[model samples]
Target chain A: MGITSGRGRLRTVSATAAVLALSGTGLVAYGLSKQDTATPPSPGRSTAAAESPSGAASSPPPARKGAAYAVPQGDVLDRSQPTRVRIPSLKVDTDVIDLGLQPNRRMEVPQNGKQAGWFTGSPTPGQLGPSIVAAHVTWQSKRGVFFELGAMKPGQRIEVDRQDGTTAAFQVDQVGQYPKASFPTEKVYGTVDRAELRLITCGGVYDGDSGHHLDNIVVFAHLVPSTAPHAHHTG
Target chain B: MRTTTKLALAAPAACAMIFAGASGAHADDGTYTMKLTDTMGNNSGSHSTATVHVMGDQLKVHITGSGFTPNSPHAQHFHGSFSENKNFTCPTSAADTNGDGQVSTEEGLPMYGDIMISLTTKGDTSPKSGLAVDRMPVADAQGNLSYDRTITLPAGAGAKLKNLHIVQHGLDANGNDKYDLDALGESTFAKSLGVSGIPQEATNPATCGTVSGASVGAEPTGGVDTGDGTTQGVEDVGILGLGALTLAGAGGAWAYRRRLGRQS
Candidate 1:
């Protein structure tokens, strides 16, 4: 019985090797044929569907040089307006309002402490470039929506629900505090290579003379891939 | 070599002719308003409006804004081409060099011509005078400044507001007591100004506007508030109420957190 089992195992190994060799040849031919096709390879067109279902199982597609971030794997959320923001770590959720330039040409702050204002002039939360959402740290002595923003740590998750059903998840990267006198307007409001978020609120010492805070607390974050694979990132 | 000298001499003659025409046109009286619009990408919420009443060489400038930083000084200038036929306009987003998103006063110069008058607190209003950015005044505690003053402009002062553009600077970016060319650039300038890694509230363009026509003594439309700084008492009460509510919310949150801790 042991002799018979050994012979059967050897036969099975041989069969497996032959099958693997054939598959390899077929793969090579498939690749050659793709190159021989009249149409050039479209880098923007993802080959995720043609590859293995598991992204880790397949060899990576050629990197698009000069591209800033990873190409999303599935459907990307459209440029819909954001309506609300929720940070799980802070246990805070608040409505959002559209903000425009004040007569002084400054960003108009949200009058209500419970809500935040998203600068409409900037990109939407999920679109490319930095999207800004500003709120008051304190209104009249009450805490504003972003009052606890400074306490948040890196890797905490934030979700902004948009006018569309889609919600863009964001992971916190860093938190910083700057005096109002030296606010980094360019860094906070400037263009970035990828979709970004900036949560701002007044911080530091309160100046009674100006009736404003001396510093502004900022939280920087980037979009987290949704469970549903998108065109840009792996799920 | 002779032709080059002749061209140089012709340049002076042409300049003299233009100056003569400007002087001749200075006597025409007209009322114009500078609706100080904010530049693209800066959202400081400042609204400044100035009415320039011209009567020959004497120019009466009535300046007002919603508010400025209580004690922060701002430098402003009347820039652009001052010509009878030339109509200068405010710069578009194309002026944002280096793509930092906010255009500085220097960056907008290509679109608007050179500075025409240095809107100084007190000094020379000559086109070549560089003191506009140096001698500006600080805004009051209420972010208000209402100064009704008559200043003398150079000959052909009537051409001054022909296509005037008002650019306001937030504060001395480098705090060097004067505006330096390098001080106008961001990042590097902010560092030199000792404001690196902080909000650039001190060095931003406060507000900007183009010259528009408005009647004399008329309240300029938009955001120029001429209120007599007496509205703080009622606002203080409202703020106190909000503060009380915030305290109550904090108390509830603390109790809830304590409960969660006990349970955990």
Candidate 2:
């Protein structure tokens, strides 16, 4: 009877220890996650310019005498096709495919919704005009690259890796939700003198009958001018 | 919800009409597009997209623009050389011949030539109405303008439509949001139009683009099907895992306390 009692106590202690170990591990994981959320990994180059105090002053001055009201010729990049996109806040990293017009002249969408599609008709990312990058919020039984796109706030960062071996970083200027019926085509696709970007995905209530969302979430952003000498070029 | 659904249903049909009207190709029908950009070196944050659809002699001109002086009439026109052999282009900052810091209308004439067709809201659509500010389209309160009109082209004007420059004139040079002679002095082309005391802001070219084939293309209308609704209403997996962990920890603590009680 005494031996059995001792063994039972030992078993209980062992179980408690095991539980404590698991709880400790959970706390450690929680800590790591908190750290991740607080400080996203700062990628090299672009982040350096963004963090610098003189970043704004370093940009080229507005055109000559009419400087007061003139739109600052912000850094415009040469035309280059974007190959990849990364939204650090959403932890979205995906390959970008070229999307052309369909036979009916509508913009083509990504086939599986896992990858992002850059509209080939618009200017490439970091060009003078608005560059469009679109991805799905969710695929069949899976979350797409831009699933949390609607949750993104202004001032977040979106990085696009271009075919020219350069990464163009963009700072979110606004996040807008519009009904699919009035999608503000001109605002989304309008011409801007500076390098701008538009990240789009489906949002709002999902309709089971139509099998689509009722609204679109668009993230408007502008290229963060690099500190490199080439950033001074203006058209 | 019902109204929203009805709007959704009607939107696609309206979009189809716009796309067809903008790009439909037929015999004697051609669509030309222009991407308007700032004429002066100073980026005015003003831009526009002009689409001209020519069906025989009927010309349908549609223009959408923003970043203009609000609530002010912007005189827009198709400017090109009358000579069939000569083609004109948009002027650059060098066109500011008088060094007034703004590109005046007469200074840009060498590049954009004379006004071929005045885009007016009513009445005449001729060069005679070029400076007729009251006849031009006034931008809305937000400094955005949308102009759509169908005009009967004069004989042989359809052929001259290609390669012409589309110029949107009028700006707030002094940032006062009104056309006045305070900032850049009197207008250079005001005398030519027989209108005196016109400010340079009233006649200065704001935006310019060269009319070309429909190769400019149109943006896709409406929303995209970007989701299949698989993950809707589901919490983030990471958060769910964390919640499960927390619950288990609490459960373990309670069990641990009960065991201590029994041991005591």
Candidate 3:
């Protein structure tokens, strides 16, 4: 009776092993098939970044000549709509557009991944609160403006050109990645005493079933008072 | 109880005065916003945005939130000590002095101060109604709550409302989806206030935010869906599948070898 039971156990183990082998082979084939179609540009290899006129990745672009105004002494700037955003290290330069909350109260993303949108609800780029700028990591198959957002490190420079023709320069302070389910809304959007900026984009494992990234990459930055001095275009 | 009665009686007179002075514009009459956030160490994923329209003594508060204890009454209040000149802000996990994982109302008082106004759905928006659970706004089936109410601020309440923090109370400590005393035991705040049989989950500060003067716009909840899975790393998936296939093949071969050996 003991021998018969041992043989039965062995048969069960063999059957389970065979099943795992079959599924594993199937999964490998599926992964290979996926590799053939998935050709989206990887992070830091954006064509837009390469084509930008300002090829230098270390220094900020020269300030556009306009009506020169005395740079404000404080970090905070008067409320002005942001027109463009440039990240020197990542070679990201994109036109800024306005974004509002969706009907569900979630932040609305840009129509495509190419442009970055400034949250209308937040304080303007150099204003005395957190200014939210968001873009997609990838739209459908194209790279987004913030595709390399997660790769950003502290001390990297981000410049936002305001509608008033003054540029708001910000120094990256910290970068964080959080699960979408537990996104720290307050830390990201809460009222801060100083002029700050938050850049957001999708990250983490992409769930094929949900067709969305599972995490969000947030970059925290503060206005660099020394670099904030720029001429406001009165025209 | 005395203060509740006094405020209830004084409410009508205040309304009459507001209506009489309706034509005159008050300089402080503007929109103020508060971005509510989690107060306790537990990442409850609860957050809310409140838009307060201050028109003279009348405050029309519209609060919308998601990820709270579903279908449970959330006791919210404007917490601050205006006369004492205390520093009012949201409490962090460090506020949990008792070493328990939760930050109780009493523990958070130092950071958020006392309740100045109870954000009840029906009546009595005073500190006396601080634990008026039945009167508070109840989250829906989806753990979302939207509250819109116009409350008459007490005589000196307007001046004190500046920079005050809004505290939204209630949490599901045991993941039971309902407020009960089983999880974290009885409410210390409620017991101190001479109320009993109330669960700590019903009174713990779940989300808190400082009120700031700003234009009214919806604050976003949760992380935004920023990717379309187009740029997912396929190489990683391929590598993972290859490793799994290798392991499975090795296991199957071993199992077959053992079975053949036993048969022989």
Candidate 4:
């Protein structure tokens, strides 16, 4: 309860501010397909801050650490498809390929199934924006890149050691299940003006015929400024 | 003023109110949205600040600056409990309860609020924070549910968005949508979204921001953070509707009290 305000007097208080604690203004994310879970688009209005289940009015995060990273304010880079991703938390380190729109903007599962494919729709990791990294939990072949992503807990450490020297470290903060149609892509992959990441894998109950997992496993983390982040990643 | 300033300087513990409001805006869920500011005091020169947006049911997010790596992705969320509330604002002081000089969040001693949000890169940094379905928030804590107390920066050009300073908004972004950020509350967007009146609770509350006993958020139910100008660091912002909730609870409490009287 780091709350400092309520019915209307400014009491001025403070609580733990995690993002500012990390000292970076950007994050990473990838895209996955799902139906919208928000109260329909409502025509002219975009989404409001997530309302309290109780319907209280509030806004988003505002804690800032007086730290600055030299992020290049320039052109959008063309992202190459990520062939694979490695999540040490789940004992997964595998290759990934690209998924295209012909297949309706999804990743192609590896034939032998050693790995899952990356959606071309989102940004590639270390590439400047949010990137979608997904893997199959199980296949006729095997477990995929993000296979164990769902099992992670808070305070658990994760490192995406990119092929390049720049490796991003993320501390797990949240995990949950969502129906295929309930995925908030714009909320998740639309645009945030920062670098971010998203790891996806099929989970929940598996529907054999539909081939869709009852839910999707999403792991969220931020790129810690590697004292020596990859040369290409930093400006 | 300098002595009070000296007393309030650097001692984050003394300014727990400030931090809670900060974390509440950036982390807390439901009725909580904290914001942070730099250089405490009314004398204003701007720095950086941010406003958290816990969109959908997932994360607390804030995407400022130029476009996110242009056609790229970024991982983001409030790195703690992320819930939404119907209304709220920031609190700026501590209410002495139980005669204790210190303010806290414990049940009997101190009860404050907080907000928070964080970001990470992928494959070396990102966590799914936007526009993706297969990938949603991984943990409850990782969800972004808070905001940075908005501030203004001196060098406000290169990355105006990154500076977490809360602006004395003239144009209503009305919940963070730049598309309608300047549509003036006269359009269909304003009428449809219902952004007409300033949040009533924000303007008036049933409680006086103080409590005789250990109240919620330092003051009693329905307090606010003057941290917007008086303090620095983080601040809690929860429209607990507690003041409202308490109203609903009064009938229940009285009935229970009467029942106890008869039982005795």
DockQ of each: 0.02, 0.10, 0.10, 0.01
Error of 3 at B221 (Å): 29
Each prediction's Cα lDDT score? 0.53, 0.66, 0.68, 0.30
Q: Chain B of model 3: TM-score?
A: 0.71
Off by over 4 Å in 4: A1-84, A106-109, A161-165, A227-235, B1-264
Error of 4 at A37 (Å): 36
lDDT over C-alpha atoms for residue B161 of model 4: 19
Q: Report, for candidate 4, the interface RMSD.
A: 26.1
Q: Please, what are the lDDT tens digits per residue for candidate 4 over residues A68-166?
A: 212222222223445445555566666666443221223333333365454444445544445555544443323334445566655455555444444
Candidates 1 and 4, the one with greater TM-score: 1
Better of 3 and 4 by TM-score: 3
The candidate 3 chain A region of ten consecutive residues with least summed lDDT is A63-72
The 10-residue segment with the lowest total lDDT in model 3 chain B: B13-22
Please say which candidate is ahead in DockQ: 1 or 3: 3
Name the candidate that leads on TM-score. Answer: 2
What are the per-residue Cα lDDT tens digits for candidate 1 across A1-235?
A: 1323567588877677568656644444343344312223232221222242555755643321111111222223446778999987778899898765554445556655677777665557776556778765555435556667767667778889998888998778887765545566666764344567888765543333334444566788887686522225544
TM-score of each: 0.35, 0.44, 0.43, 0.32
Docking level for model 2: incorrect
Candidate 3 displacement at residue B138 in angstroms: 0.6
Each model's backbone clash number: 36, 0, 0, 201
What is residue B252's positional error in candidate 1, in angstroms?
Answer: 31
| Order of candidate numbers by TM-score, starting with the best | 2, 3, 1, 4
